[model samples]
Target: MTDRLPYWRLSGFYLFYFALLGATAPFFGLYFAHLGFSPERIGELLAIPMLMRCVAPNLWGWLGDVSGRRLAIVRFGALCTLLSFALIFVERSFAWLALVMALHAFFWHAVLPQFEVITLAHLREQAARYSQLRLWGSVGFILAVSGLGMLFERLGMQAWPWAIVAIMSGILLASLWVPNAQPEARSDRRARGGFIRQLRQPGVLAFFACVALMQLSHGPYYTFMSIHLEALGYGRGVIGLLWSLGVLAEILLFMVMSKVLARFSLRAILSASFVIAVVRWLLLGHLADELAILLLAQLMHAATFGAFHVASIHFIQRSFAAGQQGQGQALYATLSGIGGALGALYAGYSWTRLGPSWTFALASLAALVAAVIIATRLSEERA
Candidate 1:
């Protein structure tokens, strides 16, 4: 709530960055489909960037922490993401697209984990206020999804790359606006624990496992939900609205996240998200033609992403030392990338061989396993 916080600038970075996600996540599969790539090929295309995330974040994050140049790193990554993605205009062939995906994602995924540390450093002790700023990213996502959906409905996915490039340009500009924020200094004795040692803590390990499982469960949704909806006879405009609806729900959740965090344990919040995810995927897979059920399932994004994400970031803030925050966030990003890559690969093959129903059912199973892990292993003592 301090006047000194670069609220708009920080929020702007998330806005444009997730704006990019809004364009890519909901529409990319459709774009590839237009190019006549098979479901398995589309999944492989999607997996490349996610696989890059497993390495890129850690490499960039280590440099940021070591150099104390986190903002510089963000700026560099944003610039590279734009430059590499521009190559999309040149080729649509599988090998060509794969190279584009790999190059752009390497630099693209590097930015967020470092930026998370930057945002947290700025928030300082009032980390609860994070939801207020992060909500703008949801707004950006909503705008991107709905607007691009309409544009695609009218003009087609041929123009999708242009929209994405524009969003990435915004991310580049926003990165320049955000000021660097160093982590608050702490006592020598308190900062003494090693990063690997923190990783070994039971709660920390369990949290990582549960989060990876959760992201793994999201593969089908991220990779093919739009394609699935299209196959079911929904038009681009309607599909866009459906995607926006989920993010709208996420924005509402974020608006009250501070209050929610004040009242609930992270374990409870994450547990609820996993349980809801189980239902959400099932509803998505089995009830595609039921608009009411689809709407309800979309709303579950409030728990699936909003609650789970805010809670996870807070957990990292508390668990890691000031010096290790960058790596901590990177590790989280790395694991998420790994899970997402595996999920995309599995979902792709499943969709082609077993169909969408089985693909989403597998996602539900992953969420169910995550829920069980949280209930059994994650410490209830965390707030």
Candidate 2:
């Protein structure tokens, strides 16, 4: 089964998908700033895409599940994303850019959740290997962040939109190479219950609540970290290296994740991730000027996003039936979007008033709450 897996094809899709993310996450806010937008405006513009995530994934997920056409959805979503993002070239006005962000993000967000379902379906009984495939996304992130960091430094930020369009074209091309897969049908009676019933299960709501909090805590980092680093006098190249260092750590963790999963309970991994997030945010908020401390905090991405994300995916696969996997993944994306939107909005409002330290302190508080929720409500055993 491992031998037959469309390893590179699947990996290629993830590579481009997250290459888009790598291009966007660390630099988009900076791009907004480059356009002379205020922090509040930048946050608002950035939040629009995240807010769309709250709506888009569940909608696309439902369409994929009902149609059993996950790959078609992925391809169409990719096409729409590319077309919509190209609108960025038309206008740089606040109103037009806002519309562009919302449009591109609506379709862009649609691609990943459905594609995740597709990837897992392809993995079948070898689902534990998910991290290996997903690690390529981190690789893509490293390349984009590190390479483009230098590119932008040389060419100036005007090139950002063009670079993203080119990468998104790659995403569309990659989607064409991968074969579609459906979740294997199950005979287990538990699957007979509807999706809502699955949601009401013990620890399920709590798990989702934590998901929102985790992503919410990330709001400041994603929305302003580049700007924040720039304020601290870091060069674009160093900033890119710092961002890539986090994903590089994530890649290393993915390489060893199967063994880690075997040794630790999902609950434990999740709780520790939240705890690390609490620490990581504080370090970023208070100590970012210290390169050594910043590096340590960046390494914690291995746990905050890397381990935590893998654990959450496994939890969903276990908690939901095969028939419900699309919606399950959709709901995960939806919650993440909700948390991220709120996080961005709040970070936007707070950043100018309370300053970066306090902004990240609020993020730490969110992670602390998540750690507590997971500790008390999540199952000690694997879901």
Candidate 3:
């Protein structure tokens, strides 16, 4: 069955897409700090992409669904992302870099949700196989984070933007190789409810609410984990390995996701993820100075992000009809963006005043809240 799918091409796009994230997420804040930016400034700058994510995905997603041109949108967005990111080399001012971050992310943020729609369309009934393809993205992330960590240690941080540009080029190339896929046609009876109605269904809104909270809890980790490690005297190379270790755990979970899904209900998986996130953040906040404890926290990435994400995707696929797939995925990105932006902003403000321990404690509080909401509001059965 997998033989006929555009498996490699679709996976290639995910690989490069996440490779860019691997480069930026772990190192971008460090790069800003290298330029003597304050934690507040670094947080604001990093949040720009998440802010763009709040708007871009919905706009492009609507266009893709209405026009049946998802692949075209993906290709065009990739091109614009690469082009806008290149402007970083021309200026170093906070204002100029802010503009570049917003511009590039506006396009880069739009690409993935649309591509997710395309991939799901291609998957059709073989949806369980999604992790098989998506595991390669984890592979890409591990490569970029680990490789660049060592490279930066040797050559200095000046190489950061150049490495990103090179990877963004690969994203563009991968986008070109993926074929287009139209959403499967549905009977009038099946399509009658429309996007808004589906969203109003039981557990749907709560699921989205929890998603926002989950990403919000992730804000400090994504925004400052590397910086935190560096302050603790971990080298850039070791910090990168720590980051890769989390994603490596994620990849291992992805390998068995189908079996996991078969045995566990989505609600069970999601709730457990949130519960794990609470512990992960607390450990990160307080015990990070202890390497073994920190490693345990990183390994929990399997539940925090890996299982949670796969469950979210499955939930979205099951909740919406074929025609509404693009919007469903876009809303997921949008809510996540909203949560992520708020998280970064709060972490920035608190990192200095409240300090790392308190900031991550706040994150743990957010996850605890999400766990409560999901446990009660989410349906026991799959949507």
Candidate 4:
């Protein structure tokens, strides 16, 4: 195994991929609204891609494990995404959009989990620096969302799909260099017999439960934060700025995470994230109109999202070594994906009925529940 590629090159690739996320997530609701989609329609469309996350990634991981062709999966996913996005231009109906979303998503969602395995192989000794590498992804996201928001302010809403297409083009171009990044050899273990047996382990199950709750808690924010901000009289540009602020803090946190995790335990970081969320969500829910309070809360993205995310990845890496990485990464995706889908759905249901204040308050409570689960269940040693 080549243990010695410059970190930035690998990180740069991640930067481009995640930046694409930043572009899509914070503003897509606006695009749907501009197209005159009802809140339900917009939520359904926003969620269609995530639903694919639950199934597609696991399938791709299975194939990558069986064939040892991880990058091949990624390349195919990238191409499929290009094709899928192109389909959006064809008909502009709900059925067409949903089908396109699901089709591209089936291929798109599968790519990342396999590639995560590939990235860990490249990380070698500095696996903890994964965040530093991932943070550029945050940078890409900020640049994309904020820059494009300003452009949309000028160009109007119909240009939204074009912006998405352009970013997808960047991903396709980068995919050309990605195949060489695949792991030379992967863990021999495939998720076979007694996948439940593996899940039965107390510590491992505990970790999964915590992560699931964390994502579940994110349901409201992920589903409606931008929409809530928009309702509060913020323009698209400021909304993107708020989104960028959170991710920018996330990037800074990622830069220091390698060191931070070394000094602290995973439980410690995750627990702190939960505590911060208690305040963060309350602030967002109760005092959203107050800009200063909101900015402070946004900065907590460092702990709430950034630190917690790195810790989760490290937990997976530490728990599953070279031979079991495929299974480990798969499990991570399963929890975050399956668990996340449910969370988003719940958030979608809660957002309109409960309204933003109560919706986010409920999300905060979910984080608190997750914290208790983690604190009570996790051990000092890896489960």
Give the TM-score of each candidate.
Answer: 0.98, 0.99, 0.98, 0.92
Q: Cα lDDT of all candidates, in order?
A: 0.92, 0.94, 0.93, 0.77
Q: Give the TM-score of candidate 1.
A: 0.98
Task: Please tell me which model should have the higher lDDT, number 2 or number 3.
Answer: 2
Off by over 4 Å in 1: 188-190
lDDT of 3 by residue, 219-301 (tens): 99999999999999999999999999999999999999999999999999999999999999999999999999999999999
User: Clashing pairs in model 4?
Assistant: 19-141
In candidate 4, what are the lDDT values of residues 100-193, reduced to their tens digit? 8889878877766777888877776667767767887889988987898788889987887887788777777776675354444444342343
Instruction: Give lDDT tens digits, candidate 2, residues 1-383.
Output: 47769999999999999999999999999899999999999999989998998899999988988989999999999999999999998989999999999999999988999999999998988988999999999999999999999999999999999999999999999999999899988775547678999899889999999999999999999999999999999999999999999999999999999999999999999999999999999999999999999999999999999999999999999998888888999999999999999999999999999999999999999999999999999888744
| Model 4: CA > 4 A from native | 1-3, 179-197
lDDT, model 2, position 126: 91
**Top-lDDT candidate index:** 2
Candidate 1, 1-383: lDDT as tens digits: 89879999999999999998999999989999999999999999999998998999899978988988999999999999999999998977999999999999999988999999999999998899999999999999999999999999899889999999999999999999898899986863325668888888778898998878998999999999999998889999999999999999999999999999889888899999999999999999999889999999999999999999999999988888888888999989988999899999999999989988999999999999999999888887642
Say which prediction, candidate 1 or candidate 3, comes out ahead on lDDT: 3
Q: What CA root-mean-square deviation does each model show from the true structure?
A: 1.1, 0.8, 1.0, 2.6
State the TM-score for model 2.
0.99
lDDT of 3 at 192: 70
